[model samples]
Target: MSSHQSPFTHPNDSSYGSLQTPDDSEQAVVSEEDQEPGPENADTDSTFGGSLLGCDTDTLASYITDYKYENGRQYHSYRDGEYWGPNDEHANELQDLAHHMYLMTLEGRLHHAPIVNPHNILDVGTGTGIWAIEMADAYPSAYVVGTDLSPTQPLFVPPNCAFEIEDCNMEWTYPKNHFDLIHIRELFGCVVDWDDFFQQAFTHTKPGGYVEILEHAVTPVSDDDTVDANHFFTKWGETVIGLGEKFGKSFTIWEESKARMEQAGFVDVVEKRYKWPMNGWPSPQHRTHGDDGGKSWKRLRELGVWNQLRLYDGVEGFMIRLLTTVGGWSYEAAQLFLAEMRINLKDFNTHAYLGVTVVYGRKPGLSRTASTETSSTETGSTKTDSSGFTVHPMPKSNFPGSYRGMT
Candidate 1:
């Protein structure tokens, strides 16, 4: 296991004091005395209100087409049963919310890979196509392509972005050595053979291009031991893990992705981990106590609320089909289990959090070697290396960009 410290401060820390209930809107508000001096002045109200299940009018104009109905939920018809989650309005809304949570987690950066001015980018399993659209806008010079099993992406996308309905597990039709960066997010339990997945990624990536993956741990844990083995959340996690094993697609792939990428001939593989508090349990006092990726106490509190909401919105979509088909549980039995799990999910006192890991690697070539040699002094400036690969300095903005208003 990686020795990365949990970004959360211990629950027993005196600064945290006691857990408090969030406001009726499910937003956490800290008194001025508890807040750290910072430049962010956005309202503390939850961004989740107003048209909760609504999609952008310009985007997703045809998201309701060609879905298979199951247990009152909608699943993708193409390669149906290949994936466990649903594709209906509720599920799509949850996916968009999850994307917002990821933006908050990453502190506004779309990806952690160091690649710059990528001319060709790909997003694997681009649910709802939110991230791909953002990337297209971020890099107007790059032509972004998003692939998925369903045509759930927006019809009205940027000119530089396009969506393809293709099952990634099958043989890829993309030209070999094509993409500048391949981004894969939250595909846990959707892939049967990760070795083949990375191999395809390696082959399709241009020499010196990068492949980046972002996945969250299915199981929730507590640093202060507040959630024990017998907890309902723990039991739910164990059930999901066992179901994945029976389904022949393990949910624990995030742990082994780095090694798989390296085996696929990718080099300079790097892994970064983060925490998503199950609810608004962490207080403002924790701001000074731990490594929270430099997020403010207010930001962490908001992230906690959003994380909890996304999980609550997604638990049934994540488990229903898997439990009934793979685990052989009756629909009623699965619903009963999910009810218990949801109860634990709403408990702020538990102080549990899910782990998010990002692993990235580069295809080896002279260009990649040249990228390492380039250096930049200006923030957010782009520099071209000897082999024509652009190197961009990471942005340092604390405010979440582009999607902040949508959140």
Candidate 2:
């Protein structure tokens, strides 16, 4: 694909701004004031109780193969109501789109752990199992295992890759100190207790193994201040963060995962941050420069288009249940709010972007007795992997995409 083209875009499609610069005369810049009004007085105490199955573990285990249907979406029955997102085909497609977006952001690198010759790899909450399948392909010798609450993964995968219907929130049954790398991505609002979650990762990861987490901030922001606190899109983010808090699972993982990893007895913790523009807003810069300097801008525009498509396609599956169950909004009210949010999201003038943070840390080697010692001595030190590639701290930028920043 060309640097400026998104894989999701068709050759003749102009809706994604494939043929236009950011400042094209045809492009309309809709200011927040000019946009239609959002839903007002949304019922915060609507009588729409959620569709949570209040069954015990034994009862759920009997029908673990079943899925709960609500709001025209399917959710995992194993841990009903624990996750806000759905497990249906639409959700799965969005998951794959997100996987591709992450690849685009990382420049096609599956991971940043610098792992060499991994023997066993574990992908937590693997969703559709695309990453695990790719990893299995990348390392034929390595046994790749993907665990998720839903059995949405494809039946045919690489010989070395396997999918398990499991929930990461519960106690893990995997062997201790086994996996060479434990990879997690985009599990922001799903996790309730991150400390215990990372502790489980630490316990299951082998000595000197690595655990990597990839999460994007839930809120949207703009460097040029085009989007403000009162914007409907901004309110959508604030509402999601608030719902997460009410559900006891904060959407602030991007800001908290690094420290949580260190506390979980992992060493060499590092965080790399990137930007996911909300739309093709950055494409104009590419056309303006028409030089090598425009390459990065072009790539950003492509990524932004992908990001916008994913979010726009995923808004219903993402917020329907949360609005009704956690936020106590009626189903109709939730739909109205989501409709307004979608309209705001389509505004290219907003120039909003979501911040992505990839945090990776290594478990202490078997020779090390205490994690405190490792943290004090080698916390931020740059180290070279066996492949002789130096791992340095990536540059940081002033992008506010986290829940804390929204506040």
Model 2 misplaced stretches (Cα beyond 4 Å) = 1-62, 284-295, 366-407
* Per-residue lDDT value at 145 in model 2: 88
Top candidate, metric lDDT: 1
Q: Which tens-of-lDDT digit does each residue in 1-407 have in candidate 1?
A: 11111122222334333323456798657787787744332222234212222223212323324577878888987677889999888999999888888887786778888776678999999999999898888888888888787767766788988777667788877778888899999999999889999999999899989999998888888777877998877887798899898888879976788889999999999888777788888775432234346566667677788888887778889899999888889999989988887788788778787777889999997444324456533334566655555566553323446544223
Estimate the TM-score of every prediction: 0.77, 0.73
Residue-wise C-alpha lDDT for candidate 2, range 1-407, written one tens digit per residue: 00111112121223322221355677678775675643321221122111112123224444665789988889988678888999999999999888877776665668877565678899999999999998888777888988887767777788888877677788887788888899999898888789999999999888989999999888987776777888776887889999999998889998788999999998889888888777887864422222112237667777778888998888999889989999899999999987887787678777787878889999988422222223322235554444444433322222223311111
- TM-score winner: 1
Taken over the whole model, the C-alpha lDDT of each candidate is 0.76, 0.74
The global Cα lDDT (0 to 1) of model 2 is 0.74
Model 2 CA RMSD to the hidden true structure, in angstroms: 20.8
Off by over 4 Å in 1: 1-65, 284-296, 368-373, 377-407
